[model samples]
Target: MKEPAHHIILDAISQSASDIHFHPTPNEVEIHFRINGQRHLYKKIALTKYKVILAYFKYTGKLDIGESRLPQQGSLSFEENKLSYSLRISTLPANSLESLAIRILPQKDIQSLHELFLFPNQFKQVRKCLKNKSGIILLTGPTGSGKTTTLYAILKSFMEDNNYQTITLEDPVEKSFAQAVQVQINPESGLTYDEGLKAALRHDPDIIMVGEIRDQSTAEFVFRAAYTGHLVLSTLHAKDTFGTILRLLDMGIKKLELEQSLLAVASLELLPLQLRKFKNQRAAIIELLEGEILSEAINKQLSPLTAIDFQKLRRKAFAYGYISEENCF
Candidate 1:
């Protein structure tokens, strides 16, 4: 029984899968692995068999095994072939059964900005923004759009050159960073994002990375924290770069505040490459809003100009033979 669970995890790692989802029904549990951005069915197991496996995960993740009526989140670590990994496990109650999802994060296998971004210019733009000593840089995108991956990559890159005191506030500290202080947010214990930022500020960190801006209060507090002369990095859910700006404004970020501490916003969309060398993997094409354009956007003066938006980047990727025609659309 342990062998089966171990083999499934190792196989998923070998395939570079990001997530393993177990959908529990009345009779069986259907397993799927999300590679790049697409889900592929793995295999199904009997309800009885899955129960043992789920129990194993719960035990390893330190979650409550008996209580399946409510959602729970926990994490467990693994070491394989000299590489370290953190599996973030989340279980949700469905009907009378419970479904589980595991997010696999490679601790030290972070891709550089060059390898993560489809275009070199976009990579350069991100690197440039990280040079700021103060202000806020936002990465916006849909779920599973590689925002977390990019955030980790850029943080690694920035830490290498600038020896800033970095700190992170994640709902569940996904991976351990040897160089930065990692804090987990557990609101039940009274450590919310707003509270985390306040405590993080007391640490005199030169760089503060919020795992995400989940609500308006969190967003507002982060912006206020940015004014205290610490460079902040965070992710927000939005459709596009322009939409990210509008979302911030709607979240009670005044136009003056935006002009004061907003550094840039990069909206990411992952594109699976057609090139054989990059098979079964995806790279990001970014819609970066910065400089004069970001300032114009602060006042709600964004233009319909053919800037480096998603469509243009996709067209560029197609022209450069980086992506297939199917992805270009």
Candidate 2:
């Protein structure tokens, strides 16, 4: 049973799969792997064999094996051929049997800012925002859109400089950095984002990274941290730069506060690149808003001076032959 389980996970890593899905039915279990924004069927196993594999995974991942009725999450580290990988495990109760999903995080896959951005101008704009000593820079994207990866790259850049004190508040602390202090948020222990931010402030951190701004309280706390002369970087879920502003407003943040400390907004989307040019599968294209352009956006002033949006980025990608026409939509 353990041999089969290890084989499945090692196969996923070898294929550069970002996620693996195990859908169990009454008689058998179906397996699928997601790579480069596409999913493909991998294999199937008998229900009897799958049960043993599931039990082994649950126990190794430190999750309660008896809790089949409720959803659960756990994480574990795996090593194969001297390569290290982090696996985030999640199980959900299905109609007949529990379904499992694993997110494969490769420790060696970290990319620098220049490597991640599709355009040099976009990279320059982001660097300018990071240079600011005090302001809030928000990154917006959906899940699997490279938001967290971008944040990590930026944090790594700062860490290398050794000029400022950096701290991060992440839910599960995705990756490890030796230069920066990372705090994992555990609600069970009363360590919420708001509480974590307050504690981080006392350390006189020059830069703060919030894993995400998920609620009104966290949003307000981020703004407060920005106002107090610290650079705050965070991610939000929105479609575009303007949509990110609307989300903050809808979250009960005052427009005046936004106008004062908001430095820039970057909305990112990943598109599959032409296979022949690169070894990696996908790259990020960003829609950026900043400076007077951001002020105009907050004021609802539509002008030609506003920064480029996602639609424009998509058109450029299509024209440059970096992506296919069907992907432009």
**Candidate models: Cα lDDT each:** 0.88, 0.87
RMSD values for the candidates in order, in angstroms, are: 2.0, 2.2
lDDT comparing candidate 2 with the true structure: 0.87
- TM match of model 2 to true structure: 0.92
lDDT of 1 at 152: 85
Query: Between which residue pairs do clashes occur in model 1?
Result: none
Residues 94-193 of candidate 2: C-alpha lDDT, one tens digit per residue: 9978899999888775578888888788888788788888999999998788898999998877766657899999888887776789999998999987
Off by over 4 Å in 1: 301-306
lDDT of 1 by residue, 95-145 (tens): 988899998988886677788987787888899898889999999999899
